[model samples]
Target: MSDEDEGPLVKKSRIFYGSLEEKERERLSRETAGTGKLKDGVKAGIAAGNINISSGESMDLEERVSERQSEVLAEFERRRRARQITVSTDDAEVKACLRALGEPIIIFGEGPAERRERLRNILSVVGPDALKKSKKDDDKSKRSQEERQETWYHEGPNTLKEARLWLAKYSLPRAMKRLEAARAHKEIPESTRTVKQQELHKNLRNLNNFCSQIGDDRPISFCQFSPNSKMLVTASWSGLCKLWSIPDCTLVRTLRGHSTNVGAISFHPQATLSLEDSDVNMVSCAVDGSVKLWSMDSDEPVADIEGHSARVARVTWHPSGRFLGTTCYDDSWRLWDLEAQEEILHQEGHSKGVHDLHFHPDGSLAGTGGLDSFGRIWDLRTGRCVMFLEGHLKEIYSINFSPNGFNVATGSGDNTVKVWDLRRRRCIYTIPAHQNLVSSVCFQPTDGHFLVSGAYDNTAKVWTHPGWSPLKTLAGHEGKVMGVDMSPDGQLIATCSYDRTFKLWMSE
Candidate 1:
């Protein structure tokens, strides 16, 4: 009985052990499933590939974007090049090309390069059919610019163009005559020319020793040589205009009407040469706001022209000697009929006080400059501003018309002297002339080749035109040089300084 019971117990024990092993296997399978699910969740949250903590993937993305941009730029360049065209190298071809491109066919200022460029642009846009029609409009614009640049605009009464033509015709023969005379003069022996020049230089050097008589109680502002070059007219800060004998420097007569500084003194073109001394020989303007006409023989003014509300700085005689142009501190310049002594035109355009005025040799144009740092050319006959001289960085103190009448020289507070071509209507040269403000500039009347400038730096400079080179620097003035002038013969240069002296310089 004990053996049978033990056998049953052992069988039961074996079954129970087997059941425990199966339960253990099932628990291990469930744990393995949970761990695999957790691993799958972590992989989904992190990413598809290995995480690049050093930003290598970001650099790869940037490189891809850069490659795309380069392709776009290359395509743009190809399109631009496809639209480009070439212009001809020849003149006629250039003109034809311009015509075809709808640009001007004839040229006033169009150079071959400019015409070519214009043609190229036109061909690029509309092709070549527009070039012939281009000339008429281009000519009109060119003429307008020329008129504006020369400051000779005129709303003519129809006869003015005819008058201009007549004058041009008249000038051609006169210029030819002058050229013939020059050629004849050039034909003279070089030794004789040298001797004449030497003699002129001797006279100029002798002129350096002139007596300085006190003309007024205050500083003298300006002095002018009489038309005959025998007498001198001086204006002073004391508001007096005095006539004096040359070389001797003896005061002859004093014209006193202005109450402030006398800024300008201009002699009539015919005064002391063809006009009588008793006639109105000089015109003077002053800071007292008045312009006075004076006779050489009298101490009183012959006529008073009073319209300016502020100081009148400079007065210029028209080549006709029939009109007077005066610049004033009121930011306006006026043209007056001298014989009638009435204002013919009130020109107001400057932004600051007008300091200097000059009439072109032809008498058809007048230039006005002031503290506005710009200059204006006005057509005297037509009463219109034709050109504005713009470019200076500071106030312009003086303006002078070249003897050729197409060039202008201006002295400015920027310490430079600028040479402007009225024909080109642009600044052709800039002379770094002085260390301080340039007070005056004057072109020689006889020879258009030379110019003179005075500066507040206590120096006077002799300059050659066209090239605008400094020929000489005259440094003797003890104080600021106020004015400079060249003799009609181009032999001597005279400079007045604030140190109460005037010095004459000659080419050594």
Candidate 2:
């Protein structure tokens, strides 16, 4: 198509060169010439001998040369030790190590790499013994922090207090029921559990890319299956959210309200089942900094919640379905009261923008992952961060709580998925999952029997639970996969990609 006919969405392919570009080129040329002259001068000086020097002056010059050589050797040794030392890539850990060594936690104008190098140099100077001591001290500090957070309290509006009380009431019964289910599950015969797991894995091993559908003009940013597994929602960079019939991959509805790229799509917990068609069944957030509530019957949003000065990265429904959670580029996450249609809490703790959020199955806690390479678990009823997930080497893009409520899985830019044990308050396993950034992770809804991950590698993978072994790879997308989710029945997997399409995967 011609550029004129292609409309505003399509850009003409033409390069523009200006006077500033020419000036920059000229400046670079002059700098290059100066460097060449300096190198030539140094070479000439090295080639010449100091034959005019007096004996005393020659002796003093030789001593100065010896000192210069020592300085060079010392620098080489420092670099070698930096390469050998195993300082953590986590900035917080590096700062702690520095503080433990009686050095400044940070220096002005220092970046992460420089801070790590400084820590490495200090460790090399103090030796491995000091590193061991620092680790111990760091562990002590972490324990103290956790202890403080356990009793952490802050005053809030009366609405927030009421919301907290409601959350406590709502979650307590669910937690009891979950515990009961767990106990009953534990009582089951080991052989029976093994056979069920084996069957599940066998089916997952046969998973195939069943079908694909072009969903949008731009990249699909997120996809999710309805709680009933009868429909799917796909959000796109074109600022549209499309709903499709599950399994058949037929477009059902097109919701158009966001004026910019949509980043998240969240179906209410009871949507497609108990929720009425005229009621708010879905929620979406976009780059326009608006969160919109959508109903199945309308093409436009039923309600728009606006206030965020930055884009919202993810939105999720509380298990109770009365509250909503959203993570934003403002380095904060907010809790929204669906009944009042207002933000109830604005939470800030991450050092960088929050990327994704998910509530625990029991509704007592919410987990958030952020660009700061950290995941935090917050108690919904207490309004305090209870667990810090701290091992990923890069920004965390997705977080999901297992249905069993004790394990949290995080997908990160490090191309890994870390599963943390909430009971132990530590990471239990890390899956070297993708060749590129892992964009999304989801555990099967019914029982957390399996985990699915989507990545920029253009692939989605199914992993067996407990063992965390690879079950299958669903590969067909022409671009990076942005999101992955499993159906409520655990019989189907859905993935959306930057290829402007979403696909269904299932056993043949």
Candidate 3:
């Protein structure tokens, strides 16, 4: 099959050289020299002897030795003067002087004399004014770092203002309702909670493989369930979004608009529930740097949103369905208003490309995890970062806000899942989940009691949240698992994999 480098069907002999090659000879010689420490032309010796002198010679030698000693003492004194540090100020004044010189005012295990010496050494540099200018600049930078950012407002039309206000109105009630649920949740008797958890465990323990079906011609990159939990949408590398019947695993629809590999697919929150069949009910982002809104009956996209500079990796809608958020390879995330059809915020904070993001259950906050191995929680209303989730050591591939509303879960290429608490602003637990990259994590929406994680290790793991004990690891896929989701009723778990298939797990 060779052409340019060789004639067709010609076999070439492997090249192996003997010692005649200059480089080979030089390499051997260098190795020998390094290990043997061989040297050339070395044969010299000095005889050991002592002087026997006459009286006159001894007297001359004494005078010469005395002069040499005096010269040595003078040289020593000169070096000592160069290194010596002297200050006439008191101890406190000495510290103040050191502070002014931008030197340490106090050092551990150092006495007052040592402190004065440090001050003098600093004065040697700073009094010369070379360090003073640099130190002043450093101090100014420190002051600047200390000053927090004030509020920033984006001037928009009255619709934007109304949107923000409406979000506040909508989210506050949801948040309060969640809080009420939380309070009632805590009020449950410990014995009853234990029994209920046991029952939940009984259900979770039966999450064995039920079915596996070829989902696409190419690898499925993501899997999402409709709001009604009646259908499964699998976005594939073949640039197709496939819809399949739940449990029965039958093909229902194939939406085709993307020209390149589809990277992300998500169903609208109101899809198949309250939304019309003619409206935009599905959203997909692809490697061609576009986000397309799709409908159920049509094979084509209803609306095309453009302006992404690079491949869009993830797209999620605001819970209210008014805005859509996306992460792109351009090292930024963007918020687009669905009603206004304009970009509201183009947020850039990740050092590398952003990968995955999830909105809080109440819709006021969004958590974005990136290839930089860091995650950020942003306040959508205020356009300010509220917290930094920075512990993952590899690219964060997935982020999920817990149903509890205050805790967040993130999966990473580091083969771990970390649960973070918004109230405490710290990681509460780390689950050493997989032998390979953890591709996705989804909290079971039933009672915030369990989480399901899928990994490149070709398995999906179910975990109990409070103790984070592994409930079970379901292994059936032949390739890396790319995405996972649980049903709204918590009875089914679907995982899509690089093997061009999706699997469902059913409890006994």
Clash count per candidate: 15, 0, 0
Better of 1 and 2 by lDDT: 2
Model 2, range 1-508, lDDT digits (tens) per residue? Answer: 7757775533422212235445655765675567667666655765685244435352344455457557655765665565578989999988877777889998899999999888888877678688788778889999998786443346878899899999999989988999999999999999999998888888888888788999999999999999989899999999999999978899999999998999998999989899899999999999878999999999999988888999899999998899999899998999989787778899988878999999999899999999999999999888889999999999999999999989999999999999999999999999999999999999999999889999999999988889899989999999999999888898889999999999998887
Model 3 residue 334 lDDT?
A: 88
Ranking by TM-score: 3, 2, 1
Off by over 4 Å in 1: 1-214, 506-508
The top-ranked prediction according to TM-score is: 3
Clashing pairs in 2: none
Error of 2 at 305 (Å): 0.3
The TM-scores, one per candidate, come to 0.62, 0.71, 0.74
> lDDT (0-100) at residue 459 of candidate 3?
93
Q: What is the per-residue lDDT of model 3 for residues 1-508, given as tens digits with 9 covering 90 to 100?
A: 4456774344232122222244544755575455333222111111222333334342343465457557655654443453554575599988766666666788899989888777666555445364456567778988876563322345666665676677788889999999999999999999999999999988888778898999888999999888888899999999999998887999998998888999999888899999998998999999989899999989899999999979899999889988899999898898888888888677887878999989999999999999989999988776678999989999999999988998899999999999999999999999999999999999987677999999999999999978999998889999999999988877789999999999989986
Q: Which stretches of candidate 2 lie over 4 Å from their true place?
A: 1-154
Instruction: Please give the ranking of all candidate structures by lDDT, highest first, separated by commas.
Output: 2, 3, 1
